[model samples]
Target: MLYFSKMDGRRWEPLQHDNQSTVAADFRLRPKRRIVPCRPRSLYHKRSITMATTPRNPRSKSGNKPAVAAPTGVIPVYDSALMQERRQRILDETRRVIEENGIESLSMRELSKRANVAQRTLYNAFGSKDRLVGLVIQETYLTQLSRMKFATAPDTMEGVIERLARVCMHFGRKRNYLKAVMDLYFAPTVHRDTITMMRELSYGNSRPWLLQLEQRREISPFLSREQIEGDMTDLAFSVMRKWAIGDIGVARMADEAVRGFLVLAAGATTGEAQARALRTLALRKRRAAGPATAVEAAGMADMAGVE
Candidate 1:
């Protein structure tokens, strides 16, 4: 059976046709609109492209997990200490070259020379310059988070502030690392997707740990957990942006950050732990003349032959 359709602008009017197949063939030959087959829902979930109307999961209303949980369960794979050291070397070098010459001028040839690793290692570790930078930033961010962990203040309010304060001070020493993070966070068009992942990892991984911060003696009892969470987030971004643009010196960046954080977090009854941590941090800053190389600051007396 064949049908003829006459188009009047956007409207189509059906007409009687003796040969349906012939009319259909003619219609196919002259397409009025392009028709494309949609990919299966499984394929869409696999790609993980987020859209406003894209139902992340058909089964889950909250869209918690995708239709399928990602392999490895959204955590880092276990690697031996030796493997971690090797990767850390690659990351440190990647940070050095990119900061020295900017991301645009970065080359594997130069990175290979500077990073003190074989060119193939760079290729194997990260597939491309973009990914190399991404991993470098990710590793640096993770390092800060790792340093924040505390046995004493597992989930206390003072403990949370103390951890945040310590991490801020630690990162404030690494000029190269700080510059690279600022670049990644601010460079939207250059590395948008990588930026998204970095932020997600930063916030997502810390949420569970943040529950410990609630109702701490150092934090305002007047503030709700929701308010504290929102304020801390904005404060972190503000400090980073200020440091990125060179508006604040390294020591002051950390100082004002911790102080400002204390002010925001301070409750009527300030804990001894909070007061003691602040004193220790301030003393460390005063003892140091200025920012030193990552190696030197680590109390590494010599970094002989390191690129």
Candidate 2:
């Protein structure tokens, strides 16, 4: 109904299509609010921009201005439960490592990994691998200590000697533990710390047992308390040394030697000289029964018959 007219060709525009076609038909649609982009700024903050760069704690060496507490190394702090669990875990892992690879193979990182703990935890708890080895020795000593059944009760000198023998034999049976001790002994200068640590730990762990052993008058008759203490300590370490060196084999001679030492220590002359006399008599009998030429034995027998 209108006349056709020519317009300016310079003006152009694109047709707008519904955006809903791009969205899934089943999807629920909502009108979105338009958002204007802006740079974030907090208005409530009081400090000026220059004040932030100036440093609030200008007097402190750290320059934080507010100041923080410094740590003191003089006092030792420990969490008892964490320490207990960590110690036990380390010990268990150490034993396993010693059994699997050998004592020399127990590296700090390897041990930490084996124990499922961090290497720092091990260093913080034990200082070094040498100290860790020392703790392992302590664990071994504790295990052996537990097997000593006669620490409290004693009936006779023979019983005490038997108990000592049993303890020595039981310790030697644990080959890995003996190897660990030997390793501690021969470890390099840096590792020697563990040896000294073990000496202290061993002496510490034995204090109570040694006290109980001293109370037995039948075990130490002539030796004064101090003398007995020194002797017992020496004897214990001597046996440990022997065990480390693998010197005590399955021989009756070692047992007899141990028995003789116990007899001497217990002062058999005081209460039971008769036992020693009987031992001497048995020795004499064995000497008389020694193997010899038949003619020589007969000649000696005939001379004895003439006498």
Candidate 3:
């Protein structure tokens, strides 16, 4: 059933037809002035329903294509759970490669093979090796932060120092990957970019730990209230670098010395334990340096003056 309708500019003359189809009634030309009532069944029978009221192109006055609105918010298109698992797998493989064969061995192809993921997948997950390493460092920091719990205020400074020492010692003993991470952290400029990124990536994870420690007077007692922050950050970086480079021996000894200083600073607890620990540590460190024979002395003096 076809019906002929006369058009007068933007208006149309109603035509008498014998068919059930209302397609002709919906053949609108001036979209702004035209209004056609549509039923759900009409939309199902003929997909010509206009859901949006906004004109496709207000400026264009005459175009056939419909305008699309831009999407809002940061929405992930990929399967989030699967993407997370894949990302984790890549990070694990990256750490393994760095730990076993050093940072030089960390290649996209090698990581892809180890992770059983394609090169494209790795690229999609982590833009590059530096990014992946940054993520790995971030995850490591987050994992460590999760384990550390802070007290509001330790009874004595010595106890606080002892607890801090135990935490450092335990971390040093556990993480064998510290050496590799330390190497990157102290590497030259070209490699230092990754370390900088790692620091930024881990800022979120570490800030809370520092804040929690600050909430407790335990941290303030060690340094002036204002000086505490700068001192604590320096101490944290120093401890991390030391442990990473196998300088834990000095740190272990320093721990005992720190305890003594804490006692003097706190004026609480007897300084006997700290005193004994410090003496034993000092003697051991010097002895451990081996007999200071004349040959070692001359070599040390020569080397010290060379640079």
Candidate 4:
């Protein structure tokens, strides 16, 4: 036990102590620092025992390791696999919303709820709803285009024409996708990526087939390979755009597109025999597709009225 009391003139007299050296040892001990407001550069944290030996995290505001800022903006992208999955989930939900309700009806808050992503994360991923919609539309266009594989360049002109006709008929069956492609086509400003994609699809995918047509002398001498490709691309787009918006039915759109390509190919055929041969095969194929159902018959009547 040790005890001290004031004696005189700022001098402390020991009332009771076993050894004076114990008092000197007590004087040698360092006092623990009390945490207080730190410099602005350093955040508030538990006061450190050793300032020289370690670093900044000790001054974290939460009294833990320094918090990392969540990622912001579109480009470099999310590093967390979980966050990446969340972003993709948002995109998939957006696509489903677009497919079911259309892009105009999509809402960030509703989508955030559906996708289990915070609204902030969606904004960080896409910048705006329009940008997100544009990406969805582009994905849609590419997906539909993927169904029309432009890889198989056939040896026969009819084979190529048949495949091209099927591309239009594919759209004819998937009226929704056709409408989406047309929507992108008519409004290039909103869906610029889709426009770029369509253009790329037209040339990069279709040109090789046209070149093959030229090599086989299946292209009309009157029209260059360029003209043939351009004419058919424009014709299919024009007809499909009408079909997409319900100006024409699937049957009429397919009829026009297939017939238009046949007429174009007719000009390019090397001989009447080959021309007749291709036209015969096309007609046989059409018959094999079965008799015009009531829908087709009604569509035919509509075409006749228009004519």
Candidate 2's error at 116, in angstroms?
A: 2.3
* 208-258 per-residue lDDT for model 4 (tens digits): 656766666665667787776777778778888888767887767766765
Whole-structure CA lDDT of model 4: 0.60
Which number leads on TM-score? Answer: 4
Please give the CA lDDT of all the candidate structures. 0.56, 0.53, 0.51, 0.60
Clashes in model 3: which pairs?
Answer: none
Q: Which ten residues in a row have the lowest lDDT in candidate 1?
A: 298-307
lDDT of 2 by residue, 159-270 (tens): 3444444444554556676677766666576455565555564344334444555554333455554554455545555556665666766233224434444444434323
For lDDT, the strongest prediction is 4
Residue pairs clashing, model 4: 219-268, 220-268
Score residue 237 of candidate 1 by CA lDDT: 63
Off by over 4 Å in 1: 1-89, 98-105, 112-128, 141-152, 190-192, 204-209, 213-231, 259-307
- Residue 137 of model 1: what lDDT? 74
Clash count list over all predictions: 3, 1, 0, 2
List candidate 3 segments past 4 Å from native.
Answer: 1-79, 101-104, 144-163, 190-230, 246-307
lDDT of 3 by residue, 71-119 (tens): 4222235567887787778888887776677677778997888899889
What residue pairs clash in candidate 2, if any at all? 57-65
Error of 2 at 103 (Å): 2.0
lDDT of 1 by residue, 21-126 (tens): 2342233222346588898888667666786895545354566664543332133343799767877777787777765665667789977877677897666556
Question: What is the alpha-carbon lDDT of model 2 when measured against the actual structure?
Answer: 0.53
Q: How far is candidate 4 from the true structure (C-alpha RMSD, Å)?
A: 21.8
